[model samples]
Target: MQQYRNKLLGKGCCGTSYTQVTEELQELIFNHVNREHDRVNEHRGSETNPEELQELIFNHVKKDISQSEENRGNLRMTSGSRALEKHKLPSFKNLIDLIIDDTVFNNNFLQMMGGMTSLQSIEIFSSDISVNNTLFDQGICKMLHLQHLEIWANGLMGTLPWCLANLTSLQVLDISYNDFMGNISLSPLKMLTSVQELRLSDNHFHILVSLEPFFNHSKLKNFYGPLPIQPHMSLKELDISINSFHGHIPTEFGAYLPMLQTLNISRNALNGSIPSLFGDMKSLVFLDLSNNLLTRGIPEYLATDCTLLQFLVLSNNSLQGQIFLTNFNLKNFLYLQLDGNHFLRKMPDSLSNYSLEGLYISDDHLVGTLPRWLGNKSCLIDIIMSKSHLEGPIPLGFCQLESLEVLDFSENNIIGSLPSCFPPSSIKQVHLSKNKLQGQLSDGLSNISSLTTLDIGYNHFESNIPDWIDMLSNLTCLILSNNDFQGEMSIRLRKLSQLRLIDLSHNKLFGHIPPCLNITIVTTAFDFVFDSHLVRIIPLREEESVEFTTKTISYSYRGRLLAYMYGIDLSNNKLVGVIPYQIGNLVGIHSLNLSHNNLTRPIPLTFSNLKQIESLDLSYNNLNRKIHSQLVEL
Candidate 1:
């Protein structure tokens, strides 16, 4: 009967209140309770033995025989979308639980909820909900019996109500992952002494700090938001990153959150030195303060006191000074990010003691040779030191690291050929661009079939582009431009069918464009969907940007833009002869640049088929012909 009522509600019950609740429905509920009582009464008058009569009475008493609906409630359920489609004001007449799951709710449903004074718990995780005003007006403040109320991942708009203090019996109130607006306040919280857990995370609320009252309150089961109050001693984690929070961290914050194990306040507008009071916090395992305007050196306490630290990210700040002076006590650390800072120092030998898995210290003013102890850190995976001052030979000991994945030393003065022994099969992306590297790579390079991106552009390598590169069949991006490689373009390049972005510009390669250069993958800038905000807007792996030329201009592609970008650049190379008609096979390629060559021929008439071409450059070449008319269709 409840299921039948639900289907009826989905079909017709847009918004019906308790006053307007169908009399039939109300009668049905009352009859259920009355019938049970009548059955027990009739059993008492029957010709049954004492034991049978007592059994009938006992079963009725345990079943719907309580004094009220609140006492009769017992079930707790977790249902998916099927349980709640397009209904409003479905009744849980027992008043101990509400019929809640998802979708729109009108004033009638909220008014109905508020009228249920005996209702003890209600969880509403709806979609596209718009609670345009505070909950107080909805009369939820009247639910004095509610002990737990959760509204997670709902598009709940509007501010919370001070009348929430009326839920004196409320023990847990989780309203996280909603579009809740306005300042988070304790005006209502101060009176709700029974609230054991109040989760207000993943909401867009303004900041105001007045949490000193909760210092010793002991009821906090973890609080998160942009509240910059002194942390409570029991709080374990605080991740208020990716907000518009400004100003310095609370001076005595560490003193309050002494027991916190995780703290991520990154991507805010915080400035000034990291709090020295952090020395008081020794239990920290994860601390990320990156992408802020923070200045001054890292707190010395992080190196000396927080030995339990596992991940420390302080990137994209104006912080200066060496990371540590001497005794670095972070032996348990696994990942460290200090990029885009002014830490003008050498690679600290103290780092070798920790079995770190990731080290990103790029775009700094550091000076040193590749540390030999890198081989000792068997867990090492990524090592990005691009645009630094580090200079020297590729350390042969690096070859010993079995877990190496990304090795980027681009824009540094690191010289010498790849050591014959320095080829880790696990390597995926290698960016040594704009360096002084020259000479032969080890034969072991042929085995790295997993290599996806290899950008060694603007280097001093001179030779035939190695046909051995063809062995990396999975190569997606191959940028070897601005090198003195004198040869006909490797015919083997035709084998790299997965090649999406290839830049052999400013090289000495002389030959006809590879006629079979039919690259796969097609997308256009105009219609390129920026994978919705629910998209991986920012990848977990630090922002990896790639520079590619399109529309005869260099553009930096990051995030999803990089994922959908496809182009080709072979300009300024000594290539010759007619452009291949097979170039038309690249119907979805976004850019094509073959300028500054002595090629004398008409543009490929087949190019009219390119529906996704965003850029087409054929300057400084001896091409002669009218453009294909169908090309205008793009």
Candidate 2:
């Protein structure tokens, strides 16, 4: 029996050589198998017993015969370790579903699954599957019970197999992100009436098709693909973005899908005016048709019907005409972005009444004064109307809004001073640059402790720097360049601990540059200049000789390296004092514009200490001596 043990476990047990086992050993093996089967059956009730358990035990004995045969094949192929032989067949056959994601496939074991009939779901994603037709033709079509199919392989090409349409129980179909090239027809999916959600985004499926048949499906809720000429029947949500569909939106399209709530048709070549019939969709809540060639005025009827609308984005289009809401009811609206359009005239007055928290209406041809009613909106927090053709003074009533935080009215033709009574406490940023506002800056501006940024550059403000301007300790950016402000340099400006940017260029300011001014702490592009009128002050030498010079005195201030300060410019001033050597202590200066000034003596050799200086413009100055070679190296 011991001699026969080697032959029984070795090759050819089921073929030419059969090693008979001893009766004593056979009885012992039979007793063990019977006891294990009885123990497993005891746990499982006889009514709903797992029939695969008995088959698994029988298959375990059959594995020994199959493994011996595999070894014979390995020996015939080549000489190697017997234990290293490939598995020709897998014993476990009760697998109802198998999913291998991002793995390699072995052909030897997969070919033995010809008897697997219970496989209901098979997903092979991101694997090294062959791109040949023989791979799909093997036994994939034979899995008749497969209802949920999702394949993410680069091998699938040409037309999909017709047998896939036979899966009547299929509820969700997603065949996207593949290289399947050909005209996609839904005729095969006609039998799959139970399908509820179909996603075909990012595919080569082009050409418009009438999806009228899918309208009758009771469970169909989501249909995402190319837009169809005929409307869906019962769809609740539809997304057809990034398609080449052209022509006008159907007028009665919303009539078919009364349950539809979301409609996205952006990034298409669709033309013509928005259909007025969209007002009939009482259930519509979200509508996005941006990035299209749609022209004409926004449909006035939509504003009346879409009372429940929360989000409406129609930017980046050729939409023209004034915004007029005759019967608009946007009380529930939270986000309204309608920028990047050719809208003419003024913003609709009705929009000011809405309880909007975020509103974007920039980059339009809108021409008119900013409505005073905008300040009345207590709920508005972020209001951006930049790059518009707005004119006239900002409404004084804007001071009434205590909730307003971010107000950007830059790049407009707005004129007149900012409202003196404007509530500066709630404002964090005020962008009133590139306008024609004139008059003295309000002294009350310094009282706004919450004010961080105040940009009033490119205006006609004429007056002395307000004494209270330094009271705004929280101010970070103060840009008042290209104005006509005249006075002695305010040394109190050094008290602003949080000052990041200070641009006072092209103005009328005089006196010696403040040595305590930390230019390296500011972060914004700083361009400071002394007043041109300062050039009139003539400096007297020790001999009491009057030295007449038209050029203004100028000096650049760079801050220390460790400090978070920005560079400073005190150029074009009547400053006639000697260049302070302490000015070289600023190591973080990036730019120094001290041109057209009445400075005396040679350039400061200490200026060479500014290692971070990117530009140094000290031209047109009243310096008597030649340029210092050390300063010229900067």
Candidate 3:
């Protein structure tokens, strides 16, 4: 094999003044590396691990490119997105295992792997690999020694090739999250008697013929497929979730899978009652049957039947009954999720027995005061009890949860002042919106210095926005709308440069819009707020909007397309003044609402600078004259 090596002799003559890389150059390098990796990995199946190959290529490219950049000296630079080229492979005969993720796959890549007959494991994920019926005839069937094959999230289409049955030596086969449609025959899967694990979930396989094909596979340890299963002793893990499997769970499920350790049948059409025999599965560690139609209360036997269970999730079911935790062996329990159910009981006192890490029982009819015993679980990290009808004050004992990170009590009737029990500097996200919480914002909130989001909107909070809010340097979102707050809009808000979204509308405030709310200051602060809350709201990207009563309409923006945005809403307030000319300095402000305010003056000429403004509402204001021609163009 030919070897390629290049050594840099010394620094360039202009070493003291090396040129900083331009965005264009960085993007060019990124694209080059990505294309090269794709080409190489598609052609070569090598002894060199894919990760090592990437490092070798990067080191080689950086060394040769850095010296050239030094010669270019100073140049204008532009901002660019970050990129990471996936590691790749080179042709080598004896390669055993290949795992590639988050890379676009093509037909050539498949052809390259087809030649690697010695491979034992092959896993590809989050790629664009298209697999049709011919995939097996081309190369996959060549891997007679293949033990494990997983190709997930690759947009695979067409029926699974029957030739898969030829790979009888297969132990594990996972082909999930693809576009495969129509009914799939289980006959081929049945032939793989040596298979230990199988996952065909998240595909469009409408109906599976029978569980008889799987019954004979005594070596099957993990199964995630349609059709009711008569489990075997070797089966340890099973997940048949997000399917159309309906009817009552078989009472003998525990007896069939005697050694089962993990079971998840959530988000299915399963109805009827949960099998009490599930508690008898001694070896089971994790159980999840959430988002089902199971009725009646939880079986009391579960507490005594499964001693080793570490994770139990039964949220989003129709189960009804007073939840009591007596006699439950919760010593080994780590997580408990009973949210979105019809359990109309108070927070169970017995839940405090275990040292749990997560507890989510939201959207249920749990009444009375917040459980004080929750403080005993010092190891608790996440607590989401949103929309639960729990009333009264938050317990002071909750502050003992020093490891807590997420706390949500939104849409509840919980009354009283904010509790000071939060573990200082530990919480990251707090949602107390749409509650009856009253009184001034507590100084205790300042203790949680790590808070990134704070929403206390839609309450009877009668006070001024606290100055300490600016001290929460990491805050990216602050929502205090619909409160009885009365004060002039605070100039201190301008100091919070990281804020991306702020909703203080519908308050009894006065005075001019903050002149410092211009784009220059906002753009500087928002530079660090990219990629923060973009993922969860992607579906709403095109119609990116926030609803307010200013214009009695929802205004939309371009969303992530314009990643850095600035907006201000000061409508329906007791303000009286001319719109500030400084507001025009906010060239990047996308939405500005100042309607229904007692302001008397002509619109400022500076409004012409709002080139990027998408939604501007100045209705119901006592404006004297006609709108500016330049502003009209905007």
Candidate 3: stretches off by over 4 Å: 1-90, 181-186, 420-423, 518-567, 578-591, 600-615, 629-634
Question: For residues 359-426, could you state the per-residue lDDT of candidate 2 as single tens digits?
Answer: 77778998888887887777777777878988888887777777877787877988877667765468
Clashes of 1: 0
TM-score (all chains, Cα) for each model: 0.75, 0.57, 0.78
Reference-based TM-score, model 3:
0.78
Candidate 1, residues 159-265, lDDT tens digits: the string is 77778878888877877777777755544665777776666666777675756645544766555566656557677766676678788887888887798887878
> Which lDDT tens digits does candidate 3 get at residues 1-634?
0021112112221112111222211111111122222221111111222211211111111121212233112111112221122232344356565555444444655666676777777766655455564356666788899998887766888777788888989999988777667665544777888998898877788666345667778888887766554657777887777777878888887777778898888878889987888876888898988888988888877777788988888887987777655677756888878877888878677777778888787878888888888877789888788878887777777777788887778778888887655544588777788789999887878766788778777888887778776677777657788888888887777777666667777888888767675234454434433331232121100122222332356432234532455667777788788888887777767777888898888988988988877788888889976886777798
TM-score of 1: 0.75
lDDT of 3: 0.66
Pairs with backbone N, CA or C atoms under 3 Å apart (clashes), candidate 3:
44-90, 44-91, 45-90, 45-91, 45-92, 46-90, 399-421, 519-586
Point out the higher-scoring one by lDDT: 1 or 3.
1
- Quantify all predictions' global Cα lDDT against the true fold: 0.69, 0.60, 0.66
Q: Top TM-score: which candidate number?
A: 3
- Of the two candidates 1 and 2, the one with more favorable TM-score, higher being better, is 1
Better candidate by lDDT, 2 or 3: 3
Error of 1 at 217 (Å): 5.5
Worst 10 residues of 2 by lDDT: 540-549
What candidate 1 gets wrong by more than 4 Å, as runs, is 1-127, 130-155, 161-179, 186-204, 213-217, 523-540, 632-634
